[model samples]
Target chain A: MKHTLSVLVENKPGVLTRVASLFARRGFNIDSLAVGTTEDPTISRMTIVVSADETALEQITKQLYKLINVLKVQDLDPEEMIDRELVLYKVSAAPERRHEIIEIANVFRAKIVDVGRASLTIEATGTGDKLAAMEDLLRAYGIKELARTGKIALARGSRDA
Target chain B: MKMTGAQAMVRLLQKEGVEVVFGYPGGVVLPLFDALYEAEGIRVILTRHEQGATHAADAYARVTGKPGVVIVTSGPGAANTVTGIANAYMDSVPIVVITGQVATHVLGTDAFQETDITGITIPITKHNYLVDDPADIPSIMAEAFHIASTGRPGPVLIDLPVDVSRGEIDFTYPERVNLPGYKPTVKGHAKQVHQAAALIAKARKPLLYVGGGVLSSNGAKELKELAELMQLPVVTTLMGKGAFPEDHHLFVGMPGMHGGKFTNYAITETDLLLGVGVRFDDRVTGKLATFASKAKVVHVDVDPAEIGKNRPVDVPIVGDARAVISAITAELRKMNAEPRTDAWMHVIDDWRARYPFHYHTSETAIMPQYVVERVRELTKGRPTVFTTEVGQNQMWACQYLRITEPRTWVSSGGLGTMGFGLPAAIGAQLGRPDHLVIDIAGDGSIQMNSQELATAAINKLPVKVVILNNGYLGMVRQWQELFYEHRYSSSTLPQDCPDFVKLAEAYGCFGIRATTPAELDDALVAAFAYDGPAIVDVRVEREENVFPMVAPGGSIDEMLGGIPGGPVSEMLDEELFEEVWE
Candidate 1:
């Protein structure tokens, strides 16, 4: 199962190393991870999504908790999480179907980030399924460019993963 | 607090415990090499070729179990390292390859010596980065090391532009690497462990198939315990040769092509195949459809992509091999025993009797098998590491050589990479200086990176190199003779050797030549007795071919045997071998 672990760490020297070394020493499969600062300047948030067994999850969480700089870690379980994915898709919007493409974007609540005479950039934020559906619908219109932030998530309610 | 971009890069590498780098200087990489020169802690060893640099780094990693570091220039230099990167990827060696890319401004402009190296290496590397900002250097380097050394370890590239390496920055190495989608699991699931145990307990003819992942995860002890508890006969892949003690009764030796015939029969007839850390490669499994057809295969791997990539698994456990093996061993403590003593052992013994690792003793010339067996005898299975280059030499080493412990045999299994031995031996020697490390090289393969003798001499690494001089690409020549109607093209080159003894002397190493068995034995003894690197060129017949080989695109059971000039046919049956044995 793919797990998204959010770790809030001190933005300082060798912090990335402390976390990465822990994973390497333990032997875990880290699929795709993104680390950057949140709204706070001093604190850095890392979202690590890797697939492993339940025991591995426990071990990873336990290891993360032991780190001196890591403030928090959450295993964003799929059912209890609201996973949002952002995609910026550039499509070939011929003059005739430009309006039609805009209508499709509106239906998905996606906004047109850029407009060109023969191309359109659609910025969409939703579940992965939603973005995948949007991409499929827009495939007939011809896709020129595609960029996606491979799924990030947060817990649905008072529960934090 | 402010430092030059080059200094920052050096500082970053230093913090990551990078002691040495293998690379060559070029226009694009000059600034980086200059910075390395100025740096105190990091030492750079200049290689004759960029590919050699990468392979040396890879060999270092394979031996040390740490990420090997390689630095090179862009364009041709970067492209040259691609083969090494692919070799690492296929064999899952962790290497940090830092290349000097064209400056950011000149990128995409196709400037002189500029190539889209990052783009070219996308599929080959675990992760790659093009540092646009000097500040990102530390973070990127840290992340690259992390990614390279972490689960399913492979090559990671950092394409640092010349300008980026020269630009000024206030250096503060990253303390944290935050990748959202990249968290690996270090622990095995309790429930899955129990499930695995239950499967093993119930299995009648269970076979344990170990792979390189076991060595990578440091799970040999756990694997041994698990094997002991279950009493399962173990068969390893080419890369998995050293995972278990080959001298043990339960150790059935390697499986698939060139593997022990008993191992092949066990896999073919087994009721359950507990495949741990192996990626069902074509060499291991001749025809996927017929492989382990009678057995229920339970695959355990850290990488999820590999689980269903080859043969579909009856039970797929995605976790670290060591952790999973420990967990399974722990779970097995609760299960009742059905020791496979009488029936299973009898069958395996029968198979062993039927098809033994044999050769017709001849006094015509020195045989490659005799050399390998002699090496094995000299080592006494005390965890002597053997690294082999591709072709007949590699096959001979795998077939005749014996390893008694985990992580003792390193080779380019999946890639079948030639010219892999010398550098790999150097890496293995550096990894464990106390252990005996040997590079079994073919004449054709040795020339690929013969310059690494300098690297060994400079480092004073005692890597023993044994070159099987056949004067031809023996494996390919055999293929041409068999399937291609004897149309030998570019396979045989009669007069291209550069007096290897002189070459070794020039590189500040000892060298010897052996034509007779006693000469070969003396050479080996001398090579092992040396305090530093030594090379032994064993001159074998030019037309020699590796036998008991499964013809290309054929089943493992369909083996070809007999001498190169002799009438070849299917090997004799089990009864004939038993009668001879008796």
Candidate 2:
């Protein structure tokens, strides 16, 4: 099963490598991961999506705590969390179908982040599903390039405590 | 108040009550070694190899219950400690390894003898530090020892750059260690302890499975108290060999692959298995899905990660084994727990009577088991510690040695590193000079760090090195004979193997070789009587195999050799049990 884990760790050098090496060593594939400074400058929060079972995830969580830098670990409920991924897709836009591509992007609340002579780079930011939907709809126009900032997440206000 | 980082390090060790340290020196570590020279309290032994130094320190920690200390130079010296670190990590031995790194300015530049020692050891060590400032030395040293000796203790590393060591600081050993994130649960949860006690009280066939954690936590007293009070039969893992008194009536035997026939059977037959500090490793629980299938397990350990890593448990208590056991003992007393019905003991006794661990002997050939048994006999009623190299020699030693006390039998259990025994003996002997320390090694493995005979002789620590001299790497040879088509290949030792006796003599230690059973006891006696280190090389049968062995994928019930029905599956059929007992 795929689970999203929010890990808070010290912002010391090599902390990221330590965290990443752990996931790799345990055979847990990180489908998506984003690390950034938390409200406290000394601590960094990592948003990671790992594909593992409940038991393996438990083991991984315990192993993470063993790291001197790691402070806390939490498994976020997909339904009770607000998550987003930012993606930029360069779709080949024919002069005739350019309006159609823009219309689909508009429906998805995406914007044209970049424009080339023959392509429009659509920047989409929302939940994983929303970005995937936009990318699927733009595929008809032929995507020339694509890049994504893997998903980042936080629990909803009910869990703000 | 100003002192160099290296000076502060020596001071901190002195404060920690470190009597001796084992290590090898190189360019980057010259400052630390220089500091040692000026220091008064600590003693240092220079090992021939960095790996040997680390292993020696590791053994020192295992036998003494004090965190072992190692100091070595950077690059090769630092990298060489990796194996020892991992070995200590896997076995949960408390060790603090301080490695000299290239100066901080040249760290990332890959200057001469620069290696990412901390990065390399990150996974293997419980925790590690790369010292950038001399002032942090006291805190880092304090934290390093604290982490290494705390809950689920393991090796911790401190990478001290030469520049940092050269820097001066106002050295003050921290009065208190404050790490918000590093709290170990020393006390058990009352409710869980109650639950475990209830489970045991109701169990008709409760078996206490103990592991290395019991010894590390000093839980052996608590474990024995509970076992005796409840009349719970105990089976130890290889790492748990000395945790429970071998002579105690409640003690059954060590279990798992290469375990005794009755021990494996008893484990298979138990209904309730209270695993204390045991991970139920694959070697201990062969064919996991089938292992203890009917048993409801209650696992108590200090490391929560190890609780369900291999096998699931019904009741999981995450705390120090000693504390948890004490809690359970208290709870059991309140509930008035009773011993299980005597029927189970009858079965265990029958199995013991039918298939005891025994070795055949001859007038001409020295049997390895006989040698171990004799060592146990000679070392009886003495403060003796035994360690062994990996493979057949290790198994035989584990099988035959009588460990009456905790911290008496130390081996490379988890990692099973081959060259561990000899250097480990040096460490063990140094730690307990009044006690007898012996390394029962195989001909193949003793050669790995036999140069450590140099370390032992130079120090004049009277450790005994007993070599079970079979002409082959006996364990692998046994495997090839059983599994493969008997192509021994590289399993065979060279025909012209080094004369261990001559080698020992050259190293300025007592040396003797025994080829017959009559000579085995005399060689051991002479070796033990020697005032200095000695090596007793006993030439055992070339084809002799240590067994009660489970084939790689086979269940514990499916033993391959050593016992009567071993290797012949049909013999283990109901007919054989009935016939053998009759």
DockQ metric for all predictions: 0.05, 0.73
Look at candidate 1 and tell me the lDDT of residue B98: 86
Predicted structure 1: clash tally: 26
Candidate 2: regions farther than 4 A off:
A94-98, B565-582
TM-score of each: 0.77, 0.96
lDDT of 2 by residue, B1-582 (tens): 899999999999999999998988889999999999867878899999989999999999999999999999999999999999999999999999999999887889988888999899888989899989898898889999999999999999999999999899998869888676788888888888989999989886789999999999988888999998888889998899888899987778988888988888878777899999899888988899778877999999999889889888999999999999999999999998887646666667767778788777777888888889999899889899999999999999888887888898889988989999999999999888889999999999898898899999999889999999898999999988887889897998852379888999999999999988988889999999999999998888888888778877678866866666532233224443344434
Report the number of the highest-lDDT candidate: 2
Q: iRMSD (Å) of candidate 1?
A: 12.8
Q: What tens digits encode model 1's per-residue C-alpha lDDT throughout B1-582?
A: 898777887787888888768888888888888888877777677777888787878877876777889889989999999989999988898999888888888888989899888777765777677788988888888888988888888898888899998998888868899765476666766777677778888876789999999988888888888888767889988888778987788888787777766667678767788989898988988888777888888889887657756687878788899999988877777666555434576667766766777786557677888888888888783557789999989888888887777677888888888888887787677667788889988888888889889988988888888888878888889889888999898898552377777888899999988887668789989988888899888887667667776666666555677322111123324454444434
Candidate 1 CAPRI assessment class: incorrect
Report chain A TM-scores, every model.
Answer: 0.82, 0.96
Best prediction by DockQ:
2
User: lDDT of candidate 2?
Assistant: 0.88
